[model samples]
Target: MKQKKPNILFIMTDQLRGDCLGIAGHPDVKTPYLDTLAAKGVLFSNAYSACPSCIPARAALHTGMLPEHHRRVGYQDGIAWRYEHTLAGELSRAGYYTQCVGKMHVHPLRNYLGFHNVELHDGYLHYARYGSVPYRESQHVADDYYYWLKEQKGISADPMESGLDCNSWVARPFPYEEKYHPTNWVTDRSIDFLRRRDPDQPFFLMASYLRPHPPFDAPAYYFDLYKDKKLTPPYVGDWEDTKLLKERGRIFDSLTGPEDEELIRQAQIGYYACITHLDHQIGRLLMALTEHELQNDTMIFFTADHGEELCDHHHFRKSLPYQGSIHIPLIISGNPELTGFAPHSVCDEVTELCDIMPTLLDIAGADIPDRVDGKSLLAFADGEGREYLHGEHSYGELSNHYIVTKKDKFCWFSTSGTEHYFVLEEDPHELHDRIEDPACRERIAYLRNCLIRELTGRPEGFTDGTSLIAGREYPVYLAEK
Candidate 1:
């Protein structure tokens, strides 16, 4: 008799920091269900999103390639996702029933990227919500969540009633009931998929959530969970440059935090509440899996597109070189025998979103495509990993490239050629700059040379093969071939 192929549940969240999980020793946030899941399986302490923004990060996950290979080194919306092979496409071809329950932030807004089906709710994308866009592509017309919300309440219902911008740090409790919240709606639709899935074939279900991203309108119950608690001060780095970093850092008013302490408090409360609410909804999925007797046969992986700065050093959003923007939580829990690790074990190997597709492909007994640049993460259990990983984003004046090893990180700005180095093992919060430290001088030079080599021959004119060039035109998208 043949063994059954395992069902994979890839649970992804938006803008959730790596340190936000209780299993990761987050001092304030409460994620009881995720903590229990991490305790039962493997936790990747150093997992990252190489291109730490929405489009590029998701490209890496779907294509199993690095940002350069995917030709989307930054967050540029509407560019065609032209990858010939994708995770969902490969899995569906491998005789599995692949279904994406929520949030496929692809170009064309409805591009399947190879999934057999997609039930999407991208959560208030500005590109789709624009007044000039075609009505067929508008959020209200295309977003299932928006359409459903209007059905539940009336044509006049809107998520914007709470008065928050999608990219702003402002936060508020959802005016509607918890059942009507997008977080619960995503889980609701996901559970419905499980009930209707084809039992004859194994499945690949992406349970993607848009909370912990922005407009932090979690239900009031969740907001109350953290609103009264003492706000933990965000990490403030001594090297923060208030003058030039507003383009890269400040998501709020100041480079340290917002001028309005009440607003900052609300942002923190709302952000943490979104995460806790996501955790509980995941618990509901776990319960559903067990009730269906599919718990043992299912493999689960949890992670995020990128980490929210959450006012770290006054940086409120992502696309920065800081840990608060790049580092993300990664927890894989299911069957110990299939995952190849002892329960409660943690792996510190430098991993990134690119590794996800190949890892899942390897686990599912599918053939990984030749375009994949990432290695299977299961190799980490056997003590296999690269010495370092390269990450970058093209943000014009503040555009930056970085090299992060397990122990440290080095960043270089494209416009000014300014360099910064940090010994991550010694300074986890990145509170101090070690660039001037004589002992780190040699290491910094080596890392800079590594960056120069990584950028060599790129059309962006970032490097001339021998050294980096400043004032070069940094492009957010690849040139037409």
Candidate 2:
């Protein structure tokens, strides 16, 4: 380490899949830089976002609390981030100079959350485009990247000129030069921070990228790299009725993917292209760290708020209890002496976004506050952590709860009595639903009871402390919160 306290370089991507990295043996996507980072540090292979969406998952990251405590169970905009203590806040109190240079996704578009300073750039929010929202508070106005884009192009230039839906399965090449892309801009601002940072105090810099999330606009070069190739096929559970696929994917922004194989392939091509683009941009950031001679001293951590379904199991977006939506890539690369684990280690611990704050706080030797409900991975390196993870999302009819372990998974829809079970070790793609299998009877019942226990005494009334309930109304946020 360079000083008594190591500088922190925390990088986050929006809606990136856990299996998108080359290091993870992904057959289609190319992420050389992330692979290298994972090889150099401990990779939490089972890392997840308990509430797999932007807003709720981020609440876990900022506060080290689960969805129940954070009160953000799903995607909802314009709600206040009412937490007093935050990862950045506590780190700032620990004498680290904190700076966030990308998406915060908190209310008001400019809520610092505890960072000493922030360079805001939350991507196309439907709430901000409304005429009722004030100009000063709107995303276009508050976003530094938007202002920079206008300066580079004409004042009238917009990222939305491509005419792509933000959450659509549609694919397209980026019209603008790579220099003007949001991913590159995030790295540019991050590199700028390294130069402008105070030399004396240790720093915490979060380079948050908003790519691989949507508009499917990778630069033409990245897009072209995979356009002609045959990519891995998107998965569909055996229980799904194939005849209704077209109906499920009829709309532009359908949650379930298209029936056409070519369109599904195009979506994969575009999504993988974005991952390679983000990976190369990350290479630039890594070079900057080395150029500044900070590579050895700075503790570099990388993760995403949530994973993209990318047409997996016929789903196209997040906020579902599926592996593609909740499984996130988590890597912490630094001095092994400080991290208490061997380099290039892979952990199977069921870690979550909630664990990030405590891990970072523990790394800085700061106090882990009582409000934190997460355990440190540095401690988990010694073979400790929960045996399984409990995840959920409040997506109306699709609102559900699940329990995932290294061996298997069990999911139950809240509003409906529907259930699904997967023996992940034997069927990693979840091609076979084992919910009704006599072989999986005992395991499913155990996991169902686990979910019931987890949901006991909740405002949603998902359980009665003994049995799992169906047809319960699930709210995006707890009423008490």
Candidate 3:
């Protein structure tokens, strides 16, 4: 007799910060269910999204490759994805029923890529929603969630009734029933999938949530949890020049200048509320798994595509190299009876979003391709991993590259050749920059060389033979063949 393969529940949230969980010691954000899940499994404190945006970060995630290999270095929309080996494709090949429940965000909008079926709900993509194309023939195809909302709340129902921009820093309570919210709708459809799935074969279900990402529209009850509390203010680095950053002009999807303290507080309240609401939905999903007697044989993983800035360093969105914009939460939990299982443990190894592919394949007894740039974290307890992780993104005027190790972080702005360094052990909030300190000059030079080497031979001409060049045009996609 052979052992039964375990089912996999891959849960992903969008733009959720790594430190927003109660287990991560967030000052006000309460995620009791996630805290319980972390206690029952392994938590990676240093996990990050290399590109720190929806398209590129998800490219790294599904392909198990870095931005350079995946060729999505920035927040690009409508480029066709042509990866040969994807997480869902490999799992489907290995006899698992792979399905995705939200936010595929792929070109053509309905492209399934590898998942056998995708119930997508990509919230408010401006390019797709308001492009020059016609409504019926363009990417404006109605998503499952939107249709469901109309069925439940009538055709005039709109998530924008709260009067908040989807990607802005403004915050407000959702203007509809809690059950009608997109977050709950995602979980609802996910539970429906589990109830209707084939019982004999092991499954790989991706419950992807798009909340906590923007519009900041959580339910009023969830918002009330933090409305009266004194939330922690965003970190202000000593080297940050707000005036200069504002002078760069307001880019799309970002707020310019310093926001008022009250507005910032409301934003934090709404952001945290969204997280908590999503956490509650997670609790419901876990309950459904147990109700179906699948909890004991399911391996659950929770993470996000990237993190939100929430006014950190005077920034409001992603595409920056700051910790608030790149760092993400990764929790792996499930049956302790499984192989190589460890309970209530935390792994601080530097991990990236790409690592998720190999990790899942390793658990499912599938073959990982040689082209993968990410390593399986299944053996994380043995202390075998990279010494440092490299990350970069094209942020228009703020294009930058970075290398993060356990002890420190180094950042380089390609537009101006400006460098910033932080000793992680001493300054966790990154309020101080050590680039100019005489004692740290050698380390800075070493990290700079490492970054330069990583950027060498790219199509953007970001680097020469000896050093990184300044003022290169930001590369959003790979040069045509």
Identify the leading candidate in terms of TM-score.
2
Clashing pairs in 3: none
Taking the tens digit of each residue's C-alpha lDDT, what string does model 1 give over 200-262? 789999999998888888888898899889978888789876554445334543223454568
Clashing pairs in 2: none
The residue ranges of model 2 lying beyond 4 angstroms of the native Cα positions read 242-244
Candidate 1 clash total?
0
**Which regions in candidate 1 have their CA more than 4 angstroms from the true location?**
1-3, 244-257
Candidates in order, TM-scores: namely: 0.96, 0.98, 0.96
For each candidate in the order shown, give its overall lDDT on alpha carbons: 0.86, 0.89, 0.86
TM-score of 2: 0.98
Candidate 2 local lDDT, residue 397: 82
| Top-scoring candidate (lDDT) | 2
**Model 2 agreement with the true structure over 1-481: per-residue lDDT tens digits:** 2479999999999999898888887888888899899889988899999999999999999999999999998889888888968999999999999999989999878889999999988888888777788888887788898989999997553588888888888889888888999999999999999999888899999999988998799999998889988788987777866543567877778878777778888889889999999999999999999999899889999999999888777788899888899889999999999888788999988999999999999999999999898999998988888988899999988888899998899999989879999998898778999899998899999999989889888987788888888998887888754
Worst 10 residues of 3 by lDDT: 248-257
Model 3: per-residue lDDT, tens digit, 75-122? Answer: 888788888899999999999999999888877777777899999898
